[model samples]
Target: MALYGLGMAKGLLLTFSYLFRKPFTTQYPEKRLTMSPRFRGNTFVWYEERCTGCASCAKACPLGIIRIVTHPRPRADVGNDYNVDVFDIDTGRCMFCALCVEACPYDALHMGGEFERASYRREDLVITLDQLRALPKKPQTQFRPHLETAGYKGDTELDEHDAGRWSL
Candidate 1:
């Protein structure tokens, strides 16, 4: 009987404890939480101007999610116009390891920080080139801040201030 009473007392104490404690839940939609700088989100970017139609990202993807279709540029003197006609990423199979981004020698790809990628159907998750291109570009300075902070030697093409120039 004493043991039963003790158990009941403990349970009641736990119930009462919450009454005095602050609520942990936030009113979402009204409030938001900031993720870490390194947080990888579900936005895909294409530096269409920079891509050399290397097809490295497509080859590196283990799930075969990346597809590239290249065509010759209008002028014979100008190089091949590597347009991503059918760049489809099946979010259903994507591990988000950022291998595709790393494999891109031209820095044409990078991880974006927008994580709310819920979809009603599996087919909806498969992002098309038009959808990927529609996404707003993240500031170049936002990516790999550590490298910039350390003053690493590399392409000085993309700096913090020059981030907002690109559109589409």
Candidate 2:
């Protein structure tokens, strides 16, 4: 009969152990959690300097939310192989699958890390070429293993020729 009250005593001890501990609460807006290297945030980081106008990213999108317009400029050897006239990404319907980033052969596209993209209207969420050009170049390295292997922590911006000639 000595073991009769043993179960109850153990349960009581477990409850009391947590009774004096402080409750856990997140300090939202002030202290945000930094996403991991492979997080595909609500934004897209498109490098116009590296895009070859191949439209592979758009083709890879299962939701068909990516749009691109490019003029053939084969004669001129410059920033990109074609003159990208329009680039539009509808963020309102994106599923964050990261497939587009993987389809990019030139490594010109990467997922952004900022998640404060709450908007009042859907139209306001559409990422145009101009906005993409202006947004901070913070690649989250979602599916790009080379960047991760290169030790890109997604804390900084990626600039021109950052991938090097052959990538690491």
Candidate 3:
């Protein structure tokens, strides 16, 4: 009957061993862990220069949280020939789906690694064009699937127009 308590003793010994070991959890705000390449953070990054205002990202969003407003550019020589006026994303309602990034024909949108997006007001959760543009730019390897499979190595001379189109 005394041997029946052996399991509990073993369990307690295992717990004590782990208690003496160095903790793996980092003290947030002071020490931060490097986010994985696949981490889906709350922040959204948009490259204004690369965006064509095609609204493909918006269409791909099932929640319709992404909103974009665009107007024709005055100069024909300019790339895309569209001036993005309003680009807003309601992060509060967002599901953190990477569909927007995958659907962007221009490869303009990317998932950011910033996870600390707590806000006091509901209105603060809405990310604007300026905010989106301010997010850190991640290499195509992070969001572009085709590029990821290609081992992120290839000709750097890809034309801007051709980069937007994704083909099967």
Candidate 4:
């Protein structure tokens, strides 16, 4: 029967076709895939200037991974400015829920796009304030209002406003 070997021939042809096609698998270490605009990465970006030390982010964390310790600083206008003494997020315990980011009213907190957070010790995952501040600033696209109302509307483009309210 002519059809008997046709199936094998087609299978071989399909296999051979892949040789010329571009690979879908990325050579991870050498070539990294660009993360989506909405992707909630593990690294947290903290804008020290915008942070009011309200402890809102800490309270919103479901896992209690965020810990904030603030001390009052005498201010001429406000009477007392809350200076954030300790702002640490135990990333190991974090579930990447983005709850903390949502609770930040000042837009001081945002999730970064850096995912290469592998570490040998658990202590290394508990990100300190210094580490958070040291991270390169990224867009603050993940907002509570945007998320709740679905305002993102499939638009992943980060605008000036969305790009980490630094100037504000």
Best by TM-score: 2
lDDT tens digits, residue span 17-125, model 4? 9999998999979997765566777787777878889999999998888889999999998788899989889988888888888888887787766678999999999
Count of residue pairs whose backbone atoms collide, per candidate: 0, 0, 0, 1
lDDT of 3 by residue, 1-168 (tens): 678799889989999999789998899889977655556778776777788888999999999988889998777565547888999999999988788888986777776667787999988999999887666654334556665565533223233333343531
- Top of the candidates by lDDT: 2
Instruction: Tell me the whole-model lDDT of each prediction, alpha carbons only.
Output: 0.66, 0.84, 0.73, 0.76
- Model 3, runs deviating above 4 Å: 74-80, 139-142, 145-168
Range of the 10 consecutive residues with the lowest summed lDDT in candidate 3: 153-162
lDDT of 2 by residue, 1-168 (tens): 678799889989999988788857669989777679788778888888888889999999999999999997756545436889999999999999989988998888888887788999998888999988988888887777778888889889878567423642
Off by over 4 Å in 4: 1-17, 144-168
TM-score of each: 0.69, 0.83, 0.79, 0.76
Judged by lDDT relative to the true structure, which candidate is superior, 1 or 3? 3
How far does residue 56 in candidate 2 sit from its true spot (Å)?
A: 0.6
RMSD of each: 5.9, 3.5, 4.9, 5.0
Candidate 4: C-alpha RMSD to true structure equals 5.0
Ranking by TM-score: 2, 3, 4, 1
